[model samples]
Target: MGQKSGGYDLNLFANPPNCNFVCSVCHGVLKRPVRLTCSHIFCKNCILQWLARQKTCPCCRKQVKRRSLVYVNKLRKAIGRLEVKCKNAEAGCLATCPLAHRRRHQDSCPFEQMACPNDGCSMRVQRWALAEHRRYCQHSAQWHCPLGWLQ
Candidate 1:
């Protein structure tokens, strides 16, 4: 699935956003959206890259200039207020945080899975449980067997 800037699952919204909140170029949720003189909105990076190649707005094909782009503060604030599910929801995370803070929670969520650090270990464990796994991982160089020969 595409990663949404606000971590929101667009399908969960009561009224799914229409064109106003979607980027014409990427056809996804807008991230750091900016508006053009033609009153069309697009993700800043998408429009800037498009402008570099052509001088017309992607939707209306109207003449536009890079300098005419302006941040859509109202839309930005609205997106920030949206409630989003944790990115690790499929991994059994049940917490729902505001869009603005979803990234922070996802970064440290107890349910976030991570690969084992041991060279030969292929285990994937939750971030919070990595330390415990590390202690017992036989593949880890730091883990010494009870017998002296295995050290």
Candidate 2:
């Protein structure tokens, strides 16, 4: 089975969400909800991707066309207002905010993972530890040029 996508994890919700807010495709909180002519709702990306493979509603199996998809703004807003834990919770970030603000929180979250900047390094370190990781990176100038030829 294809990995479910385009929705927040159910475990991220601070409280249980309404069944209406769950996407049938991903079985998680809807990200960008879209309604089909069949009256079934799914995350926008999930439905579109599914349509690309099979042009029918996964739930009702109704024949669906791309033009028949409609964005459900009110439902989207409702889902957005639901509280959710930070995606970096596992990385020691304890912040929680509305689902709508999750991206904003992640942008500044100290525990957010970031790619190493050193040209030859491929490590992913948390935002707060990036500087320290950079200083000790194996690709750093000091490690690559111990003789100080480049310094």
Candidate 3:
């Protein structure tokens, strides 16, 4: 009972503030949150700036404008009530974060690792730069030995 009460009380303050949505710009916690009549929501500043540069929702290819926009505090608060989890699929990371701001956790998560495609480099690298490393891995063994060697 105490835990439940605490959960509700904590949610009263927007306890969690992580979002799973990918930011269109800045790639941060999207400043000035906003929502549309279509139920699609995004950062107000992001939308406005996007509208200034181009008029359309990044997630949905629907027409959007500043005039048809409205603040969605209720939704935002509701989002805060949710738990966030690692976005790194395939990985066994079971971390749970808030619904408002899980992106940051996944982006900076340490468990997220990838194999170094260096023939047999046997190195675990972060997910983001995995492609570059794989492409230019010095350990990219040109010769394949029977004993399973990298470079």
Candidate 4:
């Protein structure tokens, strides 16, 4: 469970999770985990997709039926409390947030790098700095008027 995959080590959080909490299919933090009648857990979507192809528990290979799946709300809440590094950490973002909020935070993270809006400028700017960069960007002069247009 400590192994790295897709730039994230699911077991490296402030509160390390047991192997049971990791999704076998994606090998990542279990998002919306569900439990099978066989007592094995998997991400809800993962197991659904797996069941679509084969009707067996991924871990024990026990025969499973779609109706036997149950949402693991307690486990999901526990995982949500664990603190994890932002996915953009390598991009200079140093924030850490709860697993439940990680996706939302990443979507609005100020440190996320984005391409300059000006047609000729190739500079990459952090999301927080994009507005300032656009203000003085020389290439923007062609499309942006400093004075208000009367028409």
Top candidate on TM-score is 1
lDDT of each: 0.78, 0.86, 0.59, 0.79
lDDT tens digits, residues 1-151, model 1?
2533332346544346655677767776677889999999888888887889999998899999889899998998877776777777788888887677887988889999999988989999999899988877899886865564455
Pairs in clash, predicted candidate 3: 17-100, 17-101, 18-100, 18-101, 19-100, 19-101, 84-97, 84-98
Model 4, 12-37: lDDT tens digits are 46556777778888787787888999
What TM-score, computed on C-alpha atoms, does each candidate reach? Answer: 0.74, 0.71, 0.36, 0.72
Error of 3 at 149 (Å): 73
Q: How do the residues 8-81 of candidate 2 rate in per-residue lDDT, one tens digit apiece?
A: 78899988999988888778888788899989999988898899999988998999999989999999888888
Candidate with the larger TM-score of 1 and 4:
1
Q: lDDT of candidate 2 vs native?
A: 0.86
lDDT at position 135, candidate 2: 65
Pairs of residues at least 3 apart in sequence or in different chains that clash in candidate 4: none
Q: Which residue runs of candidate 2 sit more than 4 Å off their true CA positions? A: 1-6, 48-66, 135-138, 141-151
Sorted by lDDT, highest first, which candidate order results? 2, 4, 1, 3
Count the clashes in each prediction: 0, 0, 8, 0
- lDDT value for model 3: 0.59
Cα lDDT tens digits, model 3, 34-100, are 7766666666766676678877777776887679988777655655546745655346565677755
Candidate 2 is scored at a TM of: 0.71
Q: Which ten residues in a row have the lowest lDDT in candidate 2?
A: 142-151
